[model samples]
Target: MGWAEKRTGIAFAIALFAALAAPDAYAANGAYAVDAADISEVGSCKVESWMSVATNTDFSAVANPSCVVNPFTPIELSLNTNRARSDGEWSTTLSPKAKTNFVPTGIGRWGFSAYAGGSFDAATGENLSAFAVIPATYRLSETMRINLNGGWLWDRTVDRHYLTYGIGFDWKFTDTLQWTIEAFGQAGASDTPSVVQPRFQTGVRYRPNEIFSVDVIYGRNITGENANWITLGTTIRFPVEGAQPEHRRTGHL
Candidate 1:
């Protein structure tokens, strides 16, 4: 098999294994921990924003806006901004990413997708970090799904490479409310594993309709800094054709 196929196989295996052996992992599409194995519908655009509050008056916020062009069809292109404040200092970074799904997610079906992105200094334009992730998903039913992720991260600031892994679960409690949880971590590239601990998050999402959704999440070690945080987030979608796709309706933004 090819490289992507191999990773695809491994990711799917991990997803199934996680369902039986463990639990679940997105920040990419629908929820946070692992990304969704689907992209926005063609001719559609979306914006996701979240504010995180940590102890000691530290704060972080992100605004991600993305769209799928007609010719690119299934691929999503996004350019986003991340701003943070810690210890009386503030910093901003810009991230650009591209994502596409090889298989569509559905009830009783397997799905997979690839995401690649990098972050750069908004002021100096210096490269900071880059990553590539493969996300695999299984929808046991319309209301529940399992997601798994495997990838590589280049932490340029630290001059290190790490293998990344994540697992997460998404479940709909009602037509307009859902719950999600995930655990994700990384291991060092060398023989010794990473000294950092895993990060975790769980939250409820409220969607009054197809066009909008909001989230309230609690996170532990969210940035590998051993800090606890509360996040308030929102997602807004607008389809050019003015109709939502079935797949988009089933998955998170």
Candidate 2:
């Protein structure tokens, strides 16, 4: 196999080994626009897949399968593969990410996590970029929460770096349904702080059971290359035997 493929395989093997070695773990769901500050439960696994279509006729899809283990608390490791078709050409990319909740919930009524990862483009058959982000969430009420994310990304293709930020408001309407709205933006390396590109998105999530959920989202770019888009996604969790049942309290998967 190629080097990239081998790397992917090795990553998966390590994540699986960690998951299998852990004890007493469960699974959790995630959000669509903003990331949650929670990690998957120890010894559990989850898979998420989504497809997005834009007004410019570009289509893209991604699959992310992740596993969790607790050396202390819960830590997650995931692999992502993305495919896109634009202007009659297709390209694929792979990314492996690790996330952990550094500050547990109920501390100052807030939760915090750190995420880091790198992406590899199949067209180049090599590393493309890397990123690190801090995701934070605050509980507003029993049914409402707020999410914030900030990060820096190194764009290998351009040999430049960019800043990313997002804010999300999430409301749980019922036990099985929730709604979210978010505003996000990006600033390029050479762009002025005031010249950043911004986007707005709104989505709904439906959790039919403890182990499965789906989301639908609509968004529009208000800056550069403006386009409207829609996406649909689903997530499935595999809980380890004898693990305690966990419910969605923060709208995270």
Candidate 3:
């Protein structure tokens, strides 16, 4: 197996172990221990699956396929209930690792993770893949932390991999609010064999309560298409007890 495939296999094993052992390790229902310093007394996990059908599907005679051009209209909607799972966010760093404050020191806290999902395109069927991230956090002082994040995408169907890495800083201005600044590059290769572009993002997050939080993120690809996008998301996490809920999406440390 190639490096990407091997890494993915390892990540899958880790996820399976976590899912099976989560019940015993995290018995309480609504709280998570993020780090040694920050622990949530009540936490939960959330998994969100989204699907949208475009209104206008343009069929091309040359390509013999219908594709959605820019400004795709959306149709159909479904929202899940509530879930309590691990968050997927991480601090930035050179080392491709992930760890919450709760993870033990000796164990491999910072390493790899895997996910199984489907593609948005109708032609593509169900797909399962793995990804690796390197997250590092540096404490500037009592109220400031800097994070560096690098991400890699390993597609199982196409047998291709993409890479993006960036560095950012976070300032905990208050107990409940913080701001973030980040710049990342598309280090991964595309099938067309074109050079990847660099991207920049800025965002802020707010914690109204211990169990719930929200963030607004804006990003722009500077190299080629210069695509600019903004995202507003909220998260709720907690511990697991018995048979967990199927969906209700979903981050990290």
Q: After superposition, how far is residue 210 of candidate 2 from its true place, in Å?
A: 0.7
Root-mean-square deviation of candidate 2 = 9.4
Name the 10 consecutive residues with the lowest summed lDDT in model 1: 16-25
Better of 2 and 3 by TM-score: 2
CA lDDT for candidate 3: 0.31
Point out where model 1 deviates above 4 Å. 1-26, 70-73, 189-195, 242-244, 247-253
Off by over 4 Å in 2: 1-31, 71-73, 190-195, 222-224, 248-253
lDDT of 1 by residue, 1-253 (tens): 2322222222212111111111111245433656657455555677778788876567877777777644433566776677877667787877777666677676788888776777787889988777787788889887889888888877777678778888888898887898989888776654323234787889999988767889999987666656787988898877557544533554432
lDDT by candidate, in order shown? 0.64, 0.59, 0.31
Candidate 3 lDDT, 19-130, residue by residue in tens: 1111111100111101111111112233211111111221110000011111221111111111211122211111011222222111122322221211222233233234
Q: Which of the two, 1 or 2, has more TM-score?
A: 1
What is the lDDT for 205 in model 2? Answer: 90
Worst 10 residues of 3 by lDDT: 59-68
Candidate 1 CA-lDDT value? 0.64
As for model 1, its CA RMSD to the true structure in angstroms is 7.0
Ranking by lDDT: 1, 2, 3
Q: Candidate 2 residues 1-253, lDDT tens each?
A: 2322222222112222111011000011232545656444466787878787879776767777888755554557877776876556687877777776665443238777766777787678777777777767787766777777777767676677777677778787888898988876566754433325676778899988778889888867522236777878888879666654554323332
Ranking by TM-score: 1, 2, 3
